[model samples]
Target: MNEAIKSVKLADMPDYELVKSGTGGCAGCPSPMGLRIVGKALGPNSIMVMTPSCAVASIGVMPKSCYDVPVLNVCFASAGASAAGVSMSLDAQLKSGELTGEKPTVFTWVGDGGTYDIGFQGISAAAERNDDFIHFCYNNEAYSNTGVQRSGATPKYATTTTTPAGKSAQKKNVPLLMLEQRVAYVATASLAYPQDFYRKVMKAKSIKGFKYIELHAPCGPGWKFASSDTVTLGRLAVKSGAWLLWEGEHGKLTLNTPTKPLAEGKMPLTELEDYLKAQGRFSHVMKSPQKDAVIDEMKAEIRREMDFMLGREKL
Candidate 1:
């Protein structure tokens, strides 16, 4: 584990007892760790709205819950709406003097599958209304809980059960989608940068309307990477410019970290190729020339996408 990640012992974490032994999160799941850090940053008086993705499963079902704070398990497509509803209900209660506690922070925790696909409509509605809540998408790049299937968020050339070895399309730009919604806050964080991730979560909590955070979470089983390599892969993703941290607030854009312009130099294709090839998912692509061509085309698409995002006039 990285020193930063390792430094956060469970004892040092708030609500740590909630995640004690017998919790439903995967034995070594990074999702809970990310959530724990986020929950801590958000503080104890928050309500988490989880959908029918790994988050719901990991946190366990009600009556046998794992988290110390209040949690609402809604359907996969209703995370954002549920959060909005909860926020409204809380406001109503406060107005009626029916609730006597501090204002509660509402957070919607969804997977890439939920946010990038099925839950988009609800998310859009919430953002359109400028709902008061923090929406988090722990993007592992695919439908990891449903057996590593391809999702709208899955990158091109990445192998998933649905995409196979020769994926035909590029990954969906989800953060850009949120930016287009003109949400009050939109930021990207990675597990590799725990402090940054924690700070962003805290910042989002302090903000008032439709805050969206897309967290780059790596899945050991889905990515075919070693359990110990999660942070490494996350770092490599940022280093390659495949996943740059940035924020869009009220129509202005600011990159969280300085990114080398693609015009200056291209990402090392060989390094990316080796990283992909080492994974069992991309094994077939490594053996076939046609598949290699597809991978190259995908890389070009990524370059094009990045150029557009970074406001480059020409590729």
Candidate 2:
């Protein structure tokens, strides 16, 4: 990143709106905040690639797109491959003298269903090849656009349409998976930390290979929270250690501000109990006979998953 970008503060954010209002998203959804940040950071010299996710609704039905720049809405599982193709196509255009300006950045904004399940194959392939693109996974933890069905990202014991009792599996940590793919950059993001996400996007833009950001998208309707409390709820997720904020650059991981404390034992993972209770999806678990036991189990599982990354960061 340039010196000017390095010196950028929250107060210095761009006032120009890339993503306009009148989105088809749920009332109080935090998805637009992240989308707008990406738009502001990449400026006009960028193209967004997406699949059939909630974000499609947010951007609008086309002929009336909320996205100011160009967008390529690909098939369900082709986000990774399509962005790679777009990047290469732009490069070819530049090299062939058909386009004079700098090659525009191509990014994929997919939901958890697209990232962790349906599109995992294409995404994995892109990461393996180190394709050039910025990939943001809007992880609401379920197939939220398809009526809140269970997704691979759904947390253990979280109730969903398919998992009425509760999901019986742990959430897949895709950032870590991307790290394993040896991508150029990887980060965990939350709507609560707009500046943090903004900085990460800037850093990713300066790089030339696959970069991934997993956005902890807390859906108001899906997660059963009031729309206005979206950011506050997102902060609680990070504060409680249910979500950790961190960046991985060139395959090296470093836990960021709030999460660094939680991972280092300054705060307890049990704080996640409160975070869990705040969500309606986890209501079944909270009301179960063994609520404390359930929470304890979840804490242990999260700690185990996080340890793989945190331990490496310490080293």
Q: After superposition, how far is residue 60 of candidate 1 from its true place, in Å?
A: 3.6
TM of each candidate vs. truth: 0.86, 0.95
The candidate scoring highest on lDDT is: 2
Q: Worst 10-residue stretch by lDDT in candidate 2?
A: 1-10
Model 1: per-residue lDDT, tens digit, 1-315? 012333344345555332444566554466776787887787778888888777677665557777878888888788878999999999999999999878899998899999999998999899989999999999988888878898888876677888765466867887887887778888888888777787677677777889999998878788787777777777777765667777777556666553434323543423456556546666777777686676676567657766666672121
Evaluate all candidate structures by whole-model CA lDDT and list the values in order: 0.75, 0.84
Candidate 1 structure lDDT? 0.75
* Candidate 2 accuracy as TM-score: 0.95
- The TM-score between candidate 1 and the true structure equals 0.86
lDDT of 1 at 224: 86
Query: Tens digits of per-residue lDDT for model 2 on 1-315?
Result: 233546256678887677787788887676677888888788888899999888886677648988887989999889999999999998889899999977898899999999999999999999888898999998988888889999999888888989989888777788888876778989898888888888888888988989999989898888888888788888888887788898877667788877887777776544787788777998988888998898888788768756765788865
